[model samples]
Target: MLRPILFIFVLFFFKYTYGQNEIYELRVYEMEFFKPANILHDYFEKALIPALNREGVNNVGAFEESGETLPKKIYLLISYQNMQAHQDVTDALKNDTQFKLDAQTYWETPSEKTPFKRIESIFIRSVSGFPNLDKPADDSEFFELRIYESHNEDALRRKVKMFNDSEFAIFNDVGLNTVFFGENISGNQMPCLTYLLAFKNKEEHEKAWSKFGPHPEWQRIVKLEEYKNAMNDISRIFLKPLTYSQL
Candidate 1:
């Protein structure tokens, strides 16, 4: 009887702990030009994404920066159940035979013919207020990726606090549909947080921000002394999902 009771307690504890949040990996691949971009796209569509799916990661999102631009880039958002799963999937990829065979074309490309100049990877832990990544609707056409940079760790904490305590609520009130809100656990941009928002079109994107600025809750939170100057700089990028993107 005692053994059964102890087993039940342990099961409940593990479920509560691991079910609390998801981990996200954001990968950015910078291309030198359009020609090489195709190679990267092919590899993602044929090799990497399928391999991830086999490993139980089902919600991989692939996106390209919007508009006609030179020196293109691709963004991939992959979600995991936990930190352990993230590590395990990565380790498995390194030695997976089928993945290697599938990715052979990309692997065999010469240095001169390589598709991307470099890849930037950032790991994020889901915020408590928004613990899971939301999958965008099938008809969703545009995404706005925003990164808020804080001056110091204290300011970063406060900015994140403001989001948890009030801003996320106001965002929902104003029609800023969130995809994910994550604190950067490891990345180039220190003392910052990154989030993704989805919209149906450019017109809708513009209209949402218009509503957000003057919303009462957002106004009140911004005026708070503790939250003042929490963000030093902001970076915004508009993206359109690739045909195969799962987000």
Candidate 2:
């Protein structure tokens, strides 16, 4: 092998089999509060995103809650390259002096424009074995969307583990392919889990769900006391990706 290909090959074959190849998932959930909407848009554009970008945040943008007449909360799904990248990005923010200053400036500046209401943000990593995640989502076409919310921290972490652990195979076995999975971490609400499952289209999404809900393994897993108590509300919504999301 040539030097360049050999280098690339080591980066690939030696990296974990999956998400490490090209997937790093980060999802955000926000409660819809009128006072902070514009402030949020401005904050991301002017304050938060710059710091986040420096830390390797990708697909960073806010979106409205979809398929609703009167939407109550929104979410942002951000991607990274790997667990180490995710860890470094988050850890960098904690240690970054400029980020600390910017955060204070962001909150203080926003306080002048609008009042703040606390919202939850959690981050989760995606599990392997869901289909069609062979490349980065450069085109924005996806079909199955899934979100799981737990009411507390311990339970939320457990939910994250279930998706991250071997249990995630149930989704693949039932024909539900995952697009991206991550917990919310920026929007500020606590004890909530937000993730997305995208398919090729709406019909495929519906079929996937049909396969997911009634699978025999799922039935058995669903009966587990640990799974049952870990969740309080599980919400799912379909989102249409928009242009200029980086803005």
Q: Per-residue lDDT tens digits of candidate 2, residues 1-247?
A: 5999989987896665443523334343434445555555555566666777887575564555456634355455556666566677878888878777766755676454553344554555444433223323444344334556677778877776666554468776765555555555533445665445655557766777788777777677777777667767765666654343551
After superposition, the stretches of candidate 2 with alpha carbons farther than 4 Å from their true spots are: 1-65, 71-75, 80-147, 151-154, 165-167, 183-189, 245-247
**TM-scores for all predictions:** 0.93, 0.51
What value does the lDDT take at residue 208 in candidate 1?
93
- Tens-place lDDT per residue, model 1, 1-247, is 9999999999998886666578899999888764546667789999999999999999799999998766788899999988988899999999999999989998888888887889999998888888888887777899999999999999999999999999889888888999999889899888899999999998988899999999988777778899989989999999999988988
Off by over 4 Å in 1: 1-20
Evaluate all candidate structures by whole-model CA lDDT and list the values in order: 0.89, 0.57
Clashing pairs in 1: none
RMSD of 1: 1.9
